[model samples]
Target: MNTMTLWHITGWEFAALAFAALLVGFSKTAVSGANTVSLAIFAAVLPARASTGVLLPILIAGDLLAVATYRRHAHWPTLWRLFPAVAAGVVVGTVFLLWADDAVVRTSIGAILLLMAAVTVWRRRTADKEEEPESVTTRPGRLKARSYGVLGGFTTMVANAGGPVMSMYLLSAGFRKLGFLGTSAFFFLIVNVSKLPFSAGLGLIDGRSLLLDLALVAFVVPGALFGKWAVHRINQRLFEQLVIAATVVGGLQLLLP
Candidate 1:
């Protein structure tokens, strides 16, 4: 970090970051919110503030791969409904970042991840109780979308933690596997891309961070390919259980000293 070199970190740190990058791709293609692990890893490895910027481009790379793999199954109307609220949330997040210190950012992100994990678990448990799932077009559904969209945008801006929030929203809206993957692909791609200016303006996405990302991004390709190959064969229940467990551990790590 003092040297500002791409290889400034020790070998083990780089290995951890490389694995996290791979998870970013895998999460993009297979489990939607699973990258919460990657977010935690990146924040743990890099400075809390710099971690978000470093991870953004990597997430974008994964997003591109996801969109390419699941382009046809997206639900556009849902994405459209969430965008305006999400944009407002991003602005609010940006304003928050202007004053938040690294400790505050780290704590906020940790809390958000834990909260999102809880929400996901609750959604899953209650899923079978609903006789009819709400559509995004319903009056209640629009309110839900706005609420989740704002929260998603705020968290994504603050810590690249939007995935779980959006995942819950999509699940509550009743998306099946393919539609879920496709819609999320486009959603993150657009949202993350739009965040570039804000990150750069914040000095988070600097040349040094980009250099580190260059080394880490190569690992994402294979992870994404593996996800694409395994998506159909993977057991849905098992996959989500693992993701939630990992996310909980990550959140706890971030929260503790």
Candidate 2:
């Protein structure tokens, strides 16, 4: 791989980074679905392989802000139950990252996101008429955790595009408002940090990428602040619909040749 020089960052690249960072911040706070835009932008600006590494650090920065904002509302039991499964999924995803073809990864993630969106929409339409009762044990929750975890880890590791996948799962599980934000904040905080080793091992993070991350970090703060404000104003039904729509578009982009 060729090394990028610090001075090589063009005005347009900075613009792109700033915009992507804004989306990251917004996603952290307002609509988690917007991270798909961030993922697409970063991948376009940098090498697809290095984009995840470059964006991960910035994402962690944003995650810190999100946790600080919504820390009080987290559902510890839910997060705890999901941890082991998510961790397992991360390991599996990392292994695949080491060997999978880029095209295969992209298409698989796209298909998964689309399928998840379809399921989520179907469930939502049927939810009112016949609401499913919560399971007795954490088994059902764990299964959900595993399903979302594996898919989240895989899509995120490959393209930093797991936000919608996880969002759909959590929304379907019926977490409201801050609980949803808090849970997402914790989940991604762990997953993004865990991905660092795999990224470093792949030689994706380097001096130039770090410099870019530094520049982008500043944009996330305001974006997150905006997101925090937007959350309260959004209606639940509309939020779910928007999430589904974004997931569909993101998935189609990935699946496109």
Candidate 3:
């Protein structure tokens, strides 16, 4: 089904989608991986494929708000290092999408989230004992960026689930709190908006999805505002942990039922 059909959903579904949209903004601004919750919700409420289409615009909108708030602090050099690999990954993901039906897309996202979350948690635990990996910055440079970039691109393109992957990389690279949010906000703004053509070509986005996006768009404002306030007040360690936990739960939900 196309975007036009989403209007037939019930009021309860609207409520659920609206809340998911709110989380989109909050996650984009304050807690990056919290978006796994919104992704899971969208996949559950709509088919995995169509949900991806409908959710992209909403994510882009949140990205814009985040960029408006954090754009000044973005680390552009890091982005340049990663974009080439990310573009390659997007091509691979588009190929995957061509062959995947709903079940394949669903399972792929669920598995990716679970694996990435585990990696993040393990890296965090071991970070104190070892020097941060050079895989994300300096030294190994090209090889490391390509590795993370491909994974990040593939995951983001498939399920918009790249946040956790990037979060782990950025943390290991020792980005300060503001730098992390700013880099992420802009990275996704460019990336998500870039996906529009591929998504449209795949027939994943259209009038129906756009309509759903517009209706739920306003809810993102309050969520984004709350995120901005909380980011300044919350402890960084606590926020990162919460994002990981939420991602794990969301991954489990998708894999289970």
Candidate 4:
């Protein structure tokens, strides 16, 4: 929009995007898994495919803040194992994006979220009954890393909505709050930055989207600051449950008529 109508968007649309941006910041530092809410909201307010482009920069901003706060705690071995698979997934996602229509994309994202939520629940329940060693059952083996990494990369590249996949993987690997946040923070910062060239090559990122990002980015700060405070005090079990519940809700919202 021109200077005369720089603020041309409707109030509700502005409000939705700002709210979504706020959620992006909070999810980055706190839950590390609830960002699908932000993704869903951004897609609801913008075009489904373009929303991924517009939100990427804002996510990177939050990623910087989170990594600064939790840099010391990242598990490098896990990152090393996952990166190659993640790159493979990104390439796959790029190919997929070339052919998928908006409806197909929306359906794919919703289906991924719902499927992930189901997998998380099943893993949780199985772990509860079997009671295997944390080392045996919870850590990311090569296979686990490859599986989750590929899915995380594909989901992120497709919708800017891979938080749950990575979150579920970390949680299964038995990362407590700080470790979870630190590793996820570092992972997304790298992965998201890596996606910039691909998104640009696809002509997904442009001046108008950047302009909208500029308008909404300021709202991320307060939410991120709040997340840092909340993470320190939140009950761990409750936090995990909240993340899963929110994931399910966000997935369903994307699929609803």
Candidate 5:
């Protein structure tokens, strides 16, 4: 394995990486859907093939902070329901990664992101037609769970963009306020942790990746702290709107030729 030098990181690149790190922290704490932007920024700054490896550790660091802040809020049932399907999808994605061209992966990620954004917007419109529920539902319908579980698993495994997919599913299923946050945190924590062995097996977690992660870790702390503060103040409708818009833009960028 060769050492990755600081020379690869020009001032602008460093700024991009730092900004991405901050977004990672914020996304982990406040809105899981914003990870699409962080994914795009990281891939832009690093080799597309190596970006996932480089970003995973930094994400895990941010995950730890999120879990600490929102552990008690997680909806364990939803997490459990999504686990098996997600694991299977991760295995399938790992196999695909072993042979897929970088361009194919990028295009697939972009397409999926665009698809998810459309679904989210459409779902929101449909939800608006229904009366405001007196209570939130934690148990997603079986068919809905399976649909989201498969898509979330495939997207997250391939591009680390499953947040939007799952967010749409949960939103459509009618989780509100803390239930949404809790379910998202638990789902991602399990999915991200599950990805470790696959990432290592694919040679994505080398020393160079670790060194880069170390540099990015500092930025996550402040970003997460800010996200924690922001989550409480932001209205649920406004937050979802912002997340959808971000996802649409990130997906298009990834798809660019």
Candidate 6:
């Protein structure tokens, strides 16, 4: 396999990646689904498979920041209910990765992004109607959790694009702002951390990737800080619309020849 070194990246490419890294942190702290744009940017800048490897560490860094900020608000019961199915889905995703080539992976990531964006839009339309929070103890709730867990695990493992899916689930469960951020914080941190070995074994994460991550990680901190500050002040509807638009553009770019 060819190794990507800093020398291989031009100044413009580095700038693009740095901006994407910033978005990763911003997404983690403020808008959970917004990172789909970051995912697209990374994949467009790097090889599809290698992009996942490189982006993983940056995401983990953002997750750390998110956990630090929202750790106390996490709903552990919800997490527990989602884990087993997520693990199963991860296993299946790993198998798929083992067989898929770059084209397949790129196409898969594009389709997942578009699908997630559609789900987000649909969820948002019905958001006001879900007055009561969904419960995991009930049969219907358990089924919903299992289905989302599997899909989240698969999409995350494939492209690190599980945020929108998870966001939709939490919203449907009637999570308010802080609760949504807190739960997603811990969820991605644990899941992304667990994925390290798999990514390494798959030759996605390597010395070269780490080198790129080192350069990109610093930008995440400031973005996180900005997101923390802006979360309360920003226009929520406008931001969501922007996120959806960016995700759609990214997905389309990946799908087109």
Instruction: Provide TM-scores for the models.
Output: 0.89, 0.90, 0.91, 0.91, 0.92, 0.88
Model 1 stretches astray by more than 4 angstroms:
1-7, 129-140, 239-243
Clashing pairs in 3: 3-208, 3-209, 4-208
Query: What is candidate 5's lDDT per residue for 38-153, written digit by digit as tens?
Result: 88888887777678877877787888888888777676777778787777778778888988987999898789878878987887786545433423564567777777788788
Decoy 1 TM-score against native? 0.89
Model 5: residues >4 Å from true position, as ranges?
1-7, 128-135
* Model 4 agreement with the true structure over 1-257: per-residue lDDT tens digits: 12223245689989988988898889988977677888888777766777788899999989999998889878777788899999999999999999988788778877888898898888877775443332232456898899988988998898887888888787777766777788889999999999999998887787877888898999888889989999888876877787888778877877775
Which is better, 2 or 5, measured by TM-score?
A: 5
Name the regions of candidate 4 deviating beyond 4 angstroms.
Answer: 1-8, 128-138
| Candidate lDDT (C-alpha), each | 0.82, 0.78, 0.81, 0.82, 0.79, 0.81
Off by over 4 Å in 6: 123-140, 235-250
Q: To one decimal, what is the Cα RMSD in angstroms of model 2 from the true structure?
A: 3.0
* lDDT measured at residue 89 in model 6 versus the true structure, 0 to 100: 79
Q: Model 6 lDDT vs. the true structure? A: 0.81
Whole-model alpha-carbon lDDT for candidate 1: 0.82
lDDT of 2 by residue, 29-107 (tens): 7777778777777766766667778888988988898889888767677777766767776777788878877678778
Q: Tell me the lDDT of candidate 4.
A: 0.82
Superior by lDDT: candidate 4 or candidate 6 = 4
Q: Which ten residues in a row have the lowest lDDT in candidate 6?
A: 131-140
Pairs clashing within candidate 6? none
Model 5's TM-score against the true structure: 0.92
